[model samples]
Each structure stands twice: as C-alpha cells, then as structure tokens.
Target: MVGVGYTLMCEQTGPKELVEQAVRAEQAGFDYLVISDHYYPWLDAQGHSPYAWSVLGAVAHATSRIKLMTYITCPIRRYHPAVVAQKAATIGVLSDGRFTLSLGAGENLNEHVVGAWPHVHQRHEMLEEALQIIRPLLDGDNLSYSGNHFEVPEAYLWDRPETPVPIAVAASGPHSVALVTEYADALVCDNPDAAVVRMYDEAGGTGKPRYGQAAICYGPDEDACRKTVHDQWRWAALNWTVKAELPGPESFVSASDHIRPEDIAQLVPCGPDLEAHVSAFQKYVDAGFTDVAFVQVGVEGQPMFLDWAQDELLPRLREL
Candidate 1:
C-alpha cells in the first residue's frame, strides 16, 4: 500500500494541538505523520510557531502505531549538523525508530535568524556538508569534519536507535536534486513534479522512496475553505525562489498581497468534494511518490477534516 500521512504544521498550530492532532490522525488511519520545522509562520494570520523537536517528543509518547518525521528541517543554519543529528537520534529513540530525519537546503525565512543566509548554490553546498556529518553520526560513527560551510571538531550521537535513522532531503530544482541523489536515503518535494522524481531516479535514487506533500482545505462550505486557504496559505503560490529568499512572515504577507481567494484553488484543492480532494492527492501518487502527506490547510477544521478523511477520503485514495 502507498503510505498515507498527515502533516502537523508547527508553523501554524500550538504544541498541544499538534500532539492532539497526531493522535487523532493515527486513529483516523494515517500510516504516518510529518511536522514542519519552521521558526516562523509564513503569514502572521497563521499565528503559531513553536519548537518542532519538543512537539515531536510529546507526539512520540502520545501515539504508538503511527510513524513520525519532520516534513523538512534545515540543519544548515540556526542548528549545527551535529546538533541536528543528536536531535534526530533522540527522536528516533523516543519514537522507537519511527522517525525519519528529513532536511532541506533551507529558506531564508527560517535560517535568517542566525544572521547569515547564503545564496541557493551556497546553501546546497552547506547542505551536502551537513549530510556528510549527519549521516555517519546517526550511523554511530564519531565524526570530526571540516568543510567550506561548517566544522565538527568531534561529535557523536550517544543514544541512537537500534537502526540508523533514515535521512531525506527536499529538492525542487536540478541542483538540489543532485544533492538528494548523493546524500539522501529518500527524496522529498513540495509538489507533485514527475520531472524531479525522474531526475532523482536517473541520478542514482532509483530505489529510494519519494515523498511529497499535498495541501487541501476540507470544509463543508467551499467558499469558506477557499477563504481559509487564501488567508492562511496564499504565500504558497509564490515560486520557490521567492519563497526561499523572503526573510519573514511580514515579507511573505506583502509579497502575497496580490493573491486572491480564488487563486488558491488552482494551487490547492479546497472544499468538501471528495473527487477534487482525491484528484489533488493522486497527482502525488502519479508522480511516483511512495509516501504522501496530506496537509489540511488552516487551523479551524482539522478535527472535521480528519473525520472526513477517515470516513470518505482514505478509501477513495486507496483505489488510486
């Protein structure tokens, strides 16, 4: 069966609600759960950004059957690669090996807090350097490394899980995809772009799992769903270059000022239509993603959305 998952958007929800949602998602039959690791919400209206690692720890104790992972965490800045490795190892122990450490080249919005944000190319290089440190340390090696962007004098994970935690890297362009092929155990992407997957496979990621996220606003009222998405996630319509370069939520809000509520439907499926929701998810399945995480956009209707997913959506997606 294709693995179906839910995302706990740490950028938008408080820690308590995030843990509750994890439990609810598991009960609703999701195979896994992913949480975003963000220092800021994309827009002020979204209104909640908490430390994801702490929330994941609570989630580990709250849910037993569901697998857990960061949708994508950046080890390149605000966190050293060694520290990221230690955090992943602890989460792996807490979740009993259910955690997958998904990382990215990072967005300025999150990494800028450290007072230095590199260009895209430099960021990729830093990510490769980070993986060099992270992978071996997670595998129980004591690491002392030096690279253009970082240095690890001597670091080791003392409480790693029985198995090495799987590492995934998010990629959208050719350069990032190359990094994924070289250093990642799995591939992660925000969109259902087959070309990205094909590139990863042809570039030596042939057998690795491809992971992607699908965002939707599921509510009884279609117009309400659309409005909720525009209010909370319209920043998503901005291209990757813009999304990665913006430094904060204020910047995103201004950049997304031109977006209208209806425009969101083109990017994210909104409303209660089961076929519309299923079709949006099928794009990921068709794109060769082995695991898909469903993001219920906005904070208001999550419980309702989970019930809808369990009662209607999951079965329909399984047929795909």
Candidate 2:
C-alpha cells in the first residue's frame, strides 16, 4: 500500500503553522508527515525557517497518530551526528516511537554559513562516518570512533528509544544510494526515478521503505498557481548538484532568475484539476515508491488543498 504523507515545508511556514498543519494533515487522512530541515529558506519570498527539532517537539504533543520525520537533515555540518542522534532519540521518546530520522549529505545553503563547504565526495565520506557514529548511539550503545572526517569519543545516548529511531538516508546518485543501502533503514529521494529504486535494491536495500516527494500547487486560478509556484518553488527545478553547491538564497534567486512561471508549472502540478494532482503523485507510486510526501506550494491555498486531498485525491491514491 502507498503511504500518502504530507510535506511540512518548515522553510515556507513558521513553527506554529507547522504544528497546526500537522494536526490538520492527520485529520485529513494523510498517513504521515515529512518535514524539511533548513537553516534558511530557499528564497526570501518563501519566508521562514524555524528550528525543525523544536517545531517537531510541538508536533509530537499536538498530534498523536501521524508518523513524523525530517524530509532530510544534514548531520555532518552545522550539527554533529551525536547531537542529531540525541535529538532524534528524545523526539522518538516524546512521540512514543512515531518518529524517523531522515539524513542527507546536506546543502551549502544551510551548511556553508559555518565555514567552507567540502567537495561532494568529501561530504559523502563525512556522512558515512556520521552514520557509523549515529547508528550505534541510537541503538543505545556507547560509541568510540576515529574516522577520516569525524571523531566520536565514547559517546552514548542516555535517552534512546527502546527501538532505535530508524534512519532514512536521502540519495540522488549511485554513491549515495550505496551509502543508504549500507547504513540506512530506509531510502529517500525527491524524484520519480525507477533506476534509483533498482540501484538501492541491487545494493542490498531490498524490502526497505522507499520514500519520494511530489510538489504541487492547488488553486482555482491556473495563472495564480503558476505565479505562486514560480515565486516560491523555482528552486525545485535546480539539479541536486547546483542545489548542494549554491551558497545562499541570493544565489538561488539568481540561479532561478531565468525560470519562468510556465517552467515551474510544467514541473510542479498546478491548479485545481484533481487528475493533475493525482497524476503527479502517481508518478512516484509508479516508480515503486512505498511512501510519497506531498508539498503544497502556496500558503493561501493550503486549506483548500488539504480539504480537496481528503475528499478527493487521497481516496483515489489509496485505491491504487
């Protein structure tokens, strides 16, 4: 069965709104929640980036049934893997084991604020080491490791969950896919690529949950939907390599300057057509994704979108 989840774009909304949305999503029949962890919004127009962990704490109390996870968190920089393990453990306990920790190599937009960003291979190496440190700690074991990129000095998680919080690694390439297969409990990607699933399975990730994301704009006016998507989500069209390297929101704005409304409309399902929205999600399902998260593009249309999803889109997807 396809697990239809909602994407809480912390970059696009404040903490209070995020918690509120989580409650609404659960009520609307979304099976789980996937939230983005970012220090900055992709564009100034997208608006806010509250600390995702704190917001998640609020979500845990406010909603009870829905499973929660970071769409992807970067533990190699800005945050040590130890701290991430601790946070995930505490949140898991607080949520009564309804949380998963989704990790990635991270992007320069968030990590570059601290210091010079490393090369792609170097970052992946760091991530591998981080997973090494994180996995044992989450299992309630004391860890000691000296790796090329990280050092864990006899670390232990005092507040770990009884069952370790599952780690879902986000991968967009062969190397990352292999890393996830080796280290992660689940595999995550944003696009509908069957080859990614095949690669993960071939690399020993068979039977693990495969998660993917779909971005859409739901509104009555097609023109307005196109404009909203262009203004807020043009960054969606950038390749992961470009996204991983760009320094800040300004760089993203410049990179997306040539992106037109039609360009965004073509990529993201826009307007209020039910079939268009259903088809957008179906692509990921067709690509063999077991879990799919939907990100609504504009704030103004969120309520309508959720209502429509509960009344129309979700039931249709469930039938598949």
For candidate 2, write residues 1-320 as lDDT tens digits.
Answer: 98999999988898988898999999999999999999999999999999999999999999999999998899999999989999999999999999999999899999987889999889988999999998888999888999998887778888866788999999877998988988889999888999999999899988899999999998888888999999999998898889999999999999999999988889998887988988988999889899999999977787888898898989988887
Candidate 2 at 297: error in angstroms? 0.5
Q: After superposition, how far is residue 250 of candidate 2 from its true place, in Å?
A: 0.9
TM-score of each: 0.98, 0.98
**Can you write out model 1's per-residue Cα lDDT over 1-320, one digit (the tens) per residue?**
67999999987789999999999999999999999999999999999999999999999999998999898899998899999999999999999999999999789999999887998878878889999999999999988998998988988788989999999999887888888877779999988999999999889998789999999999999998999999999999999889999999999999999999988778888888899988878898889999999999989899999999899988887887
Candidate 1 has which clashing residue pairs, if any? none
Q: Which ten residues in a row have the lowest lDDT in candidate 1?
A: 175-184
Residue-pair clashes per candidate = 0, 0
Local distance difference test, per candidate?
0.91, 0.91
Displacement of residue 317 (Cα, Å) in model 2 is 1.3
